[model samples]
Target: MQKLSPVPYGSLIFAPMEGITDEAFRKTILKLYPEWDYLATDFLRVPSAGKYPLKHLVTHFGKELSDVGWVKDKTMFQILTSHRSFTVEMVKDVAQLGYPWMDINLGCPSNTVTKNGGGSSLLLDLNTLRSLIKNIRENFPGRLTAKIRTGFHDTSGFKDSIRLLNDEGIEMITVHGRTRDMMYKVPAEWNYIEEAVKISQVPIVGNGDIWCSADVDRMLKETGCHAVMVARGALKFPWMAQTYKRGFREETSHERLQKIKEFFQEYRTQLESESISLRGLLKQSKSVSRYMLDGVENGEAIRRKLLLSQTPPDFFDILKSL
Candidate 1:
């Protein structure tokens, strides 16, 4: 029942990573590091044919929709859809569910999403993007936000995209400074983010390649964005946001390893309680381990063992030895 800024000044947000930032993962992260200013659900894709039923929306959002505690206020619901026909009605349903914050996904670059005329592909067609935003704004009375890449293939349309979002009353935009074509092959172009902040009427949140507490400060100082959103960086260092806000303290290698071990143990427990089968849990653990063990000592070898792990106990045992 209370409205909040989607991207408050100096806020730190945990980016919505598909398949990674699910309900269980969010709960685990919040339990360990509750300092994040906002948390976002991985985007819920709206079918082009018809409006999503209220029951289906509730199921997709999981328990966060029903939560009335502080977590509800800190969490935001995100949706992805290229079709404008059913968008307004679906958003109206979302409003009735009592979410005060919502975000449209305009940055996803996966072939499946783009080929369907959704995600970054929408950047190529401002007309459709404009119609979608205009309709959703008229129907949804909440903080309407968007996440975007600079452009589909180049930076030519980047400024225009920002202006269009501003004109449509987008309250905040998270700029992930890479064109859809560039993907993750090169470094993020923060200069474009700087340009966005300079020209936009709404607050901009800078996201890309932020891997540590220092990077968080550097992004804020460099881009002058209202906030910073951490994606893969959070997967690598789950405590990064808490460390940034509380002050980064030096940790010994042993201490870091212990913390990593404990974090995964908690994640494993959460997955088990959610009724995930051993095979499913193993798959998820390995997926996260790819990020978690990237820079740890002997991480490559540990990851190899982790990937080869056949059971949950074996997986955790390998992690514990690290």
Candidate 2:
């Protein structure tokens, strides 16, 4: 069977996050820390109502597909859609664009997505999920993978979900350790991830609540997952993949602050090149700063001040003072 370009054991994946992991952010992170084994695109939602043109797909993936061979190699094209007909067509387009693998998003908990029978909503309907995967697998020539929450309302279907994906010839699975309803309010149940590893025929990647290197170690040891996918945690520490690859030493508070400064500078440059307006730039900056600053001293106060800033210069001035 075909497989995703192989990833090493204990690999670190930078999770796809909507609105936050756009081309600018991805390029900045890859520029700063090149150790990430895999990176995923934010889910490209295939419209249920019409044909998804190849041009739109090209625009969504941006430079990840158009330039930088290594970025293309490390990245996974992700799609979120329950419309099997649209998905089959979209997967064919994606394969023609040369993506080596594609991932189905079955873990998004947003009400907007679930209301439309996409994302984690599929978890509640296994028959639909199975059909969607089967259809895509039949159409796409490359490897196929999926990311799923434990279940819709509870984890009673967790093991069965793994079994189903395996049966459908899914090359890999990433299990986020919470039901759709649990969201991020509670601790991730790593035990379920361990169980997935046991029952799964392919690699199982553990995801959720991995905020630091220590959590990565714990998740790998506890769950025996083939890898760990960092979501919000990657925003918090963009250097995390590099840190883990470099043997997990704790960086000094000053070192971390300096890194944050550099990251924002690089991030700003990328966003500016994309022609984002000043207001747009500030909004994006704050979204990233909110997570990146959590470990810094007086971070909350700094975040509040940064939030009040009306312009990019103002935001950077406040960060510089820190």
Which candidate number maximizes lDDT?
2
User: Which lDDT value does model 1 have at 173?
Assistant: 96
Q: Give TM-scores for every candidate, taking all chains together and pairing residue i with residue i.
A: 0.95, 0.96
Question: Once model 2 is optimally superposed onto the true structure by TM-score, how far is the C-alpha of residue 175 displaced, in angstroms?
Answer: 0.4
Q: Over the stretch 102-203, how does candidate 1's per-residue lDDT look in tens digits? A: 899999999999998899999999998998899999988878899999999998999999999999989999999999999999999999999999999999
Q: Which ranges of candidate 1 are over 4 A from the true structure?
A: none
Let me know the TM-score candidate 1 reaches against the reference structure: 0.95
lDDT for residue 309 in candidate 2, whole number 0-100: 97
> Which residue runs does candidate 2 get wrong by more than 4 Å?
1-4
Supply every candidate's count of residue pairs whose N, Cα or C atoms clash at under 3 angstroms.
0, 0
lDDT score for candidate 2 against the true structure: 0.87
Model 2 is weakest, by summed lDDT over 10 consecutive residues, at 63-72
For each candidate, the alpha-carbon lDDT, in order, equals 0.86, 0.87
Model 2, span 1-322: residue lDDT tens: 2344677899999999988888888888788888888888899998786667787877677754446666666788899998543777788888887777789999999999999999999988888888988898898877788999999999988888899999998998999999999998899999999999998989999999999888899999999999999999898899998888778887887898899999998999999989999989999998888788787877778878999999999998987887
